[model samples]
Target: CTIGFGSKAKNIVNEDMVLAKVLRSQGAIPLVKGNLSLGCLSYHSSNIIWGEAKNPWNHDRSCGGSSGGDAGILAAGLAPFSIGGDLVGSLRVPGAFCGVIGYLPTPARNSVIGCLFPTETDTLNSE
Candidate 1:
């Protein structure tokens, strides 16, 4: 299991996130970090560190975002699974573009990662 660099914890050693811990307990190894969107809300995946994540199918196209790297890695068979967050289609968009399944767990269901968005705003939405 690997996490997206864009969402990694800002620690000296880059400590694992909750989801990573769970996966580790299950004997999964944390390998690498994938690239993700700017500020994780731009609906596109790219960064100064890792550069842009291009679509495996068509290099000219984007892999979609925030979770774009997650989908791309899976589509390319680079890993069994990559951790990512899906707020406002972050996961779905990339999954669709990469032709992989991107799932958004029910809010607070698994507590995988902290919401990057401000918590003052309610996350529930009918749209």
Candidate 2:
């Protein structure tokens, strides 16, 4: 149940988990994916794929896709925090490129119910 990167996770957003941290910290669930949409985020839903982050510093090039919006918002100081998914470098790539702190939790530690499914299985495997 993985929504491949690039144009797949293009514009899907869901309600933030009310108890994501509580559930995870208690081990009820390993991880949670929220807050980031390549085209939207908790702070905004601009449906902008190419517009992406303003680079916060660069203002040139894109912050990446699918989760690009989230990365940009976070990096640009729009919000102090955010959550996002990364199937093919959405989180890490833009994070590095935007010069922001992005954390791709340890394997089996986070559960991506939307973009990727079967939280019990790893979706990062290469085809």
Lowest lDDT 10-mer window, candidate 2? 41-50
In the range 1-111, model 1's lDDT, one tens digit per residue, is: 213354544534446666667779999997766678777766678876678999999999899997788789899999987766565787789999899988765665554
Candidate 1: worst-modelled 10 consecutive residues by lDDT: 118-127
Best prediction by TM-score:
1
| TM-score for predicted model 1 compared with the true structure | 0.76
- TM-score of every candidate relative to the true structure: 0.76, 0.51
> How does model 2 fare in lDDT?
0.50
Q: lDDT (0-100) at residue 37 of candidate 1? A: 75
How close is each model in CA RMSD to the real structure?
5.1, 7.9
Task: Give model 2's TM-score versus the native structure.
Answer: 0.51
Query: Candidate 2 has which clashing residue pairs, if any?
Result: 31-111, 38-66
Q: Which stretches of candidate 1 lie over 4 Å from their true place?
A: 1-14, 112-127
